[model samples]
Target: MNTPKVAEHIVNWLKEYATNAKVNGFVVGISGGIDSAVTSTLCAKTGLPTLCVELPIHQAKNQVSRANEHIKQLKNRFDNVSEAEVNLTSTFENFKTVVPSFESTAKLDLALANTRARLRMTTLYYFAGLHGLLVAGTGNKVEDFGVGFFTKYGDGGVDLSPIADLVKSEVYELATYLEVPTSIQKAQPTDGLFGDSRTDEDQIGASYDELEWAMQMKDAGKTVEDFSGRDLEVYKIYTRLNRINQHKMVPIPICKIPNNLK
Candidate 1:
């Protein structure tokens, strides 16, 4: 509903999660976008030590700047706001060098893009483990459970998602309620992978609004024929992502032992 109540509910929910999981605080990657801004704000409101990280590659000046702005905003809202920046260019290059025939400029879009997501997740978990805080995913419901716009074992792996119930549009509303900076709120949603060539919406082939609509219909257990053409396309992407990334979302499996023999 309103900003304060929405924020309060998120904070309370996070606190309960932390208590139940026995965690000291929460950590999230602030990508200088609305989703991260609102997520950071919620973590701040929880009064926990919220650590925001900025993972930048070459030519990501704008995203890096915005991430700094996000950290500034968080400082005003929370007491334990701190930031760490890690450059991923060298690591990305190294990975490519070691893997024979691993082309960084691969034709397969997911191959290149997923590398960035995985790196960001690594950096987030590094801090999460060091600080004894749970990694708070910034993915919204539309992205995570909807189109599956997250990388398997990457952004998809998280201790908890505070905004998992909010779609992209709802996240913006919450951002407005919290008085998040206009620049951060209105910025284009991007994964900041290729800076100019690649973006979240570009790869997903639809806007968050379109994806949300399709997700709502599917979540309600509606049939596919009921959806519009654009919505149907988005739903197709969601279904494919879910099937392809099934292993990433599930726990590790072990070889079964014969009960009678044991």
Candidate 2:
């Protein structure tokens, strides 16, 4: 892909969408990952107000630092860029207190992690509403379509997705062209929802590169019978996730009433 052309296209797309929608600009949740860094930069390139919000709920220090670094870089480079930091540790704790507690299980832990993402999503929308900006999504093709590795309405909630069609590798290319902070560009991708340093690969059991390949293979209609060894393993992992997370990839189902019944 022509990285420069892709970047230009996305920037123009964002500008046109915001202009047509009658919104001022965009507000993006900065996770210090390459996806958000690239996304916020694309929004900044539109020459409109771009608010980079930092909502941390017991976040890892490195992740927080990377987010701060990226936001600082964007502010320095773009005149329309601004920043907001909302430490949600106390709010998260309060939320946990009000909700009934269960024994520490993987399911409970996962739910809390998702809660963190939802909190950040809410915070981003709050800023967007206040400023009349659209909530810019940072998900890439692999996560959004291939594996559905995003929270349903948490980080997945957005007014527009600038990079949903680009795969992880393609996003990295854009990150390089956008001059995102090297710290973020090189950092392992994580949702930062769990408050620990676990990488997305750890959660998915496959690297983005592997998933991308599997995604391509699936798009070409190849099945598990066509691979072996590590290839087979990755294929199986990818297909299983794609199958289970189909709900995220598709629109919500609505039961239609029959005309005769009506």
Best by lDDT: 2
| lDDT, model 2, position 180 | 92
Positional deviation of residue 48's Cα in model 2 after best superposition, in angstroms: 0.5
TM-score of each: 0.87, 0.99
lDDT of 1 by residue, 72-165 (tens): 8778666888778788878887876676674455464467667878988988999888989999888888777666677776777788888988
User: Which candidate gets the maximum TM-score versus the true structure?
Assistant: 2
lDDT scores for all predictions?
Answer: 0.79, 0.93
TM-score: model 2 vs. ground truth: 0.99
Give the C-alpha miss distance for residue 83 in model 1, angstroms: 1.5
In the order shown, what is each candidate's alpha-carbon RMSD? 2.5, 0.7
Q: Which stretches of candidate 2 lie over 4 Å from their true place?
A: none
Off by over 4 Å in 1: 102-109, 227-232, 238-258
